[model samples]
Target: MTDTAPQPIDLDALPEEDDHDEALTTFRARVGAFELHWSVDAPLSVVMTSSSHVGRAGVGLIEVLTSAEQRGRTSQAYWRSAVGERLRVQGSHITSDGGAERAVIVQTDAVSGLEVRSTVTAPRGTTALRIESVVRNAGREPVVLTAVSSATIGIGRSSSDLDRVTWGSAASEWLAEDRWRETPVRELLPDISLPFHGQDGRGHAGVTSHGAWSSGEHLPCGYLVRGDGEALAWQIETSAGWHADLSQTRNGGVLSLLGPTDLEHQFAHELLPGESFTAVPVAIAASAEARDGVIAGLTRYRRWLRRDVAGEALPVVYNDFMNTLMGQPTTEQLLPLIRGAAAAGAEVFCIDAGWFADPAIGDWWSTVGEWREATARFGEGGLRRVIDEIHRQGMSSGLWLEPEVVGVDSPAAARLPDEAFFQRFGRRVQEDRRYHLDFRHPAVRGHLDATVDHLVEEYGIRYLKLDYNINPGAGTERNATTAGDGLLAHTRAFQDWLVRVQQRHPSLRIENCSSGAMRADYALLSVTHLQSTSDQQDFLLYPPIAASAPASILPEQCGNWAYPSSEMSDDETAFTLVTGLSGRLYLSGFLEELRPAQRDRVAEAVALHKALRGELADATPFWPLGLPAWDAPTVCLGLRTGSGDLLFVWDRDAAPAAFTLPDVSGEVEVLFPAAPTDGSGWRLATTVAGLSVATSAGLGARVLKVRRG
Candidate 1:
């Protein structure tokens, strides 16, 4: 190892190999503001010595466990695996593009016969480093890959000082999404004073998502911060199931990330000869500031990774679901609703469900496959009239399609091959009367492709709300080695299919909805246009869900529903409309039944969202009152855009409410409804810290556009 200053790397220049025999050597690469230094042993086994963030020194050692099963292989108490210093470097290189540099290091397992390739990329002017791994089977026989590590790095401190660390994770569900809380490392893993307590830390903290729904269980993200403002945030960008583990290493703390495992999630992918499986990508960002700084860096990295998508203006969509219609949409029922949605300024009118269901059959869920217009429900002109009416109102026509599922009773179910659907022991894995379609099969993909192509070409559909309702346990064991392996392959194939669908239908705007927000992950969010934040029907219970949505998804792509009905109070209508305006306006409810005044409130919110929606594309979110608690009476969400700041203040308390906003000083004006005609006035005053806002009415919310004057 040399004591020379770090030097800049030229992409065109050849990298000088620091070849050593039975000796320790170091390899260095300058990526943006961070300097990555690797310690390579005699067998080319590399260990990250430092991944420094600017002026700070690198913290944490990445643990690599080589064995599929955890046996006593190494002295390191990191895990239950026959681990070793076994990363043999085969080759390495550097590439530059779009103000970023990527250092690709290739490694191989001599005994196990697995080729592991690591890509460490860093964008210019940022301290964020994105790391991803790909594992390929290079053996003669089949190899079962139980776990492929995305990242395993220790925190930059001693074992005794682990008390200074705080860990954060988000618990997500149907209505209760994005509930984040922090816990101290000392409390999570108590210090063990015994010398024979095994060198590893006392306990482990981890999060895992099971089945097809990636975010169904827990969010694939976590953050570790020290009391001294140093923080490390990471996210697993997988559409399928994944996990992130943080445990005690002898040094400080170690973090390991992977897409499922044999022990957890019934995941063991058997790789045939010459077959390679690319693990889910995980990103880690270092910030010397705090948890907020770490989140901001990770957000930027997410944006950079999503630069290739067919992104366009985020449009306000109206679906005839939720309280109104509720999946029973006929031509007669949808025509007026479509017209009303357009009148309310909705840019897309999606006919959700029942469109393909036969009216004769009471239940529509099971008879789902062949996506034909049920003539019994639609009448003479059929569903075309509803779509034409939507276009007539100057809105795009969107349809709901659960393209991956086929009912056992469905006509198409019998037509496709047995391999097209998920099967176990030569039997289809049935869940809730629906058999999950295996996207890995060409026949399954062909059926979905035809359905999408027909909808887009025939009906002139510009938008698609792709929904997945059921979770068929692990996956199919037929035609694959492991059920988990089969699921992972299908997940990857589904993502690839989405890209191909976009390529074929370039202008189609897809909304990723799984029952609700179950499958909301970067694997789909990175490619899809929008995400349905939640399916919470109670307007009172929706504020927290909508407020916390930006933490899990991009504000521009979060389709928060504002399902206002004619049966609600004026204040209640305003509250729901405000919820929709807070994120991407996903208008629902009985718009056709609303009175002029109620409709006007909805229109006002729509107008306000239209004015602010453009800024949402580039806006960064900040919570003045912290991330919304699921049961919090009052919630506030702030979006800092290029133009100005937009603050959403909700008063769900019994009486009047006041908010102490952070870093906001201006003459705040209620942008929606122009002036409050309901006799409720909002008072805004400047304070030393920020701004003080008090609303006259309770059980209401307001969207305030801040102007510093």
Candidate 2:
């Protein structure tokens, strides 16, 4: 909390430089409770180790393997031995932002003529450190980089306390998403024997994503928890593929993070004499208090990273997609929905898919280009009337667009050149009749630009739902050294295009969706506005996904759909609305068919959401009943916002519902629904453990607003 204002710290002025213990050179700094230490092999820069959350004693706990590969050898970064060559430190320095933010820079050069600059930064008021590495070609000849480390952290050697490390990661899919599991490290590397083995560990455990959809396969984030529950959590922020591996080192364990590598991602890029490439940024946060503490650090960092891009207050968005029309919408179907959405207090009314689908075609997926209004489906001037109606109802008009895909049966498939599409082995890459567009091509950009411009200018649209459905594996090898390199290049190009589009239309809001939560990568989320939490049609099964979304995405930006139908019971309607009110409220379903009571419930939920929206912007998430299990009958998610804390609880099986929340001395009030349904009331009492609540409304949910006593 010094008034230093981010000035450079002199690296040579430190008192301990001349007074080194043995051959290891130590550089240390205090960033809150976290102590960051970096060590160098005095004369040779071959071994530079960096560790964070170091205790008061400040011993070397983490180790990073810095040995250079043999000349022209295709050795992967984490899977190689540190015996061939060594790297020499070129320069080192530190800087501070005058607050709690500080950064340490270490520059090194390899004998193979490769220059690497690694920077580690700890932002203001957080226990997390962000690391990024830039590798440049310093030689006269072309050098191929197969694997490069983004950031690495080491924990313990052979300590029994560390041996019980448990790792956790999330598994995702189209409907079932955010399924997290924690297991012992021994189970991950069972074959690797323990005790006295060289300086490095026997094996490693990690999760890797291989395509543009970073979270499609496995979330690029995880945690390592000791037996006592003290944990260190980390996340890799990349739109393309990424890898994070944890392996036991001589006296500890090392967690190494990298973008796309040759082994897992088929990534290899050639660097010309003066060419340079920067690895994706990764962050590791620590918590001594509890597991939730680790999540809090990451949550703060996620908000900090989005400070620049997350513009304005997020409002309730009603998209007529999942569970509602299901892509079959017309002028007749949308007019009533638009009015109903506005009446339900939606800030934005988005007409989902089938707007451009040919009326004659039975399947709309194949004919998904041109981005034009389907006049046949919506009588003459039908679509325009519905859009104007939405605007007249005091709501912003929105549209859903799958811009990255070109259906094989669409006219644009024949219009755009083959070079504009992803190619492998000189042939176009098509998955399920859809060709992926390579943003590196100008034609692809031009098409999407014109589409967006027309949608915004002609229709007066203010919001857009940008969705990607298919994954074309790695990437196109056309005009690139490797498929992964091309994919990464294209991914960056697409992000750049999004930036330009946003610049052109500063007021326009874009929602990032990938058939659900697949492509919820920071590379896209950082630039976009809202993220679709999941596409789970079963409202009962969506609590876990909605509750855990804050772990990966910001709460205000998590667009959890609440599609309540007339067929649902009163409790079911309230349950669904609670899910929406808990997050951004991506509203949907047949609102026109609902009873007056149901409509009032929906309207009240939207009102509660609007009231909570401002507080949600600064809220930090907490799990009252632990991280929700996918099939848990009782689940609760709490958010501590500026005004107060709000706890959302859902009872699925209609059993006796009781929840013990975290310690919060206060008077709790039901903020949503305006009135209790079925004349049932909630029982609230304070206990030694925490705030305990019991509810008589079976199979229902509620958002309780806390007023601190």
Best by TM-score: 1
Please identify model 1 stretches exceeding 4 Å from their true place: 1-24, 42-84, 139-142, 194-198, 677-679
- Cα displacement (angstroms), candidate 2, residue 75, comes to 11
lDDT of 2 by residue, 1-709 (tens): 3332222223553334334443234544444445444445421111112222222122222112322343222323263323112444445555566444554444444555666666666777777877767777778877777766665555543434356778878888878877887878768755344445443454677889957778887888888777665678888878787998766544456567778877788888888888998777787778764567788888888777776673566878999988888898888888889889989989999988899876788788888978999888889776888898899999999999999999999999999999999999999999988999999999999999999999999999999998889989888898788999888888889989999999999889999987897888777887899999998999999988898888788888899999989999888998899988778989999898998989988988888788788888888888877787788888888888877888888888777777778676587787865655556667778777888878774687888888876
- Model 1 over residues 150-187: C-alpha lDDT tens digits? 76665644566577888888888777777787889878
What's the TM-score of each model vs. the native? 0.91, 0.91
Q: Candidate 1: worst 10 consecutive residues by lDDT?
A: 52-61
Relative to the true structure, candidate 2 reaches a TM of 0.91
* C-alpha RMSD of candidate 2: 4.1
Model 2, CA-based lDDT = 0.75
